[model samples]
Target: MLRWLKERLAQQNEAVATAVAAADLVDKRYAAGLATYLQVLSTQNATLVEKRQLVDLQSRALSLQANLSRALGGGYRPEMTMTANAHSTVADKS
Candidate 1:
C-alpha cells in the first residue's frame, strides 16, 4: 500500500505540474485578450485543486511510511517526524 501510494503521489506531482503550466498559459492568454478572465480563474482554481490533492497524497504516503516503520520495529526517526510536520505545514499553507 505504501508503494502504491508513493506511485500515486509521483503521478499526482506530475499532474500538478501540468496543471500549473496550463494555468500559466491561460493567464498569458487572458493578458493577450485571447482568453476570458473566467478561463484564467478556472485554470488557476484547477491548479490549486491539483496541488491540494498532491499534498494530500504526500501526507498519506508519509503516514503509511511511518506506520510501516513502526510495524517493522524500526521506529520513527526525528527527521521523519520533522518531514511529516513540514508536509503538514505546506498543506496548511496551501
Candidate 2:
C-alpha cells in the first residue's frame, strides 16, 4: 500500500507539472496571436478540472489506506491472513 501511495503521488506530481506547462503554453500561444483568449480559457479550464480530479482521487485513496492501516493495527502482516482464517474456523465450530 505504501508503494501504491508513492506511485500515486508521483503520478499526481507529474500530471500537475504537465498541466502547468500546458497552461503556460496556452498563454504563450495566445500572446503570440496564434490562439485566442477563448482557447486559452478552454485549455486552462480543462487542466484545472483534471488537476482537481487527480487531487480528489489521491485524497480518497490515501484516506482509505490510512483507515485501513489503522484498522489493521498499523500495517499489513501477511501472516495475519492465516490467523484470521483460523479464528473464522474456530468461531464456526462454536
Give each model a TM-score.
0.72, 0.61
Worst 10 residues of 2 by lDDT: 72-81
lDDT of 1 at 68: 78
- The sequence of per-residue lDDT tens digits that candidate 2 reaches over residues 1-69 is 467777877887788788888889989999999999998998899789778978887887778777887
Question: How accurate locally, in lDDT, is each candidate?
Answer: 0.87, 0.83
CA error at residue 1 for candidate 2, angstroms: 4.0
lDDT of 1 by residue, 64-90 (tens): 778878886887665677898999999
Clashing residue pairs found in predicted model 2: none
| Candidate 2 overall lDDT versus native | 0.83
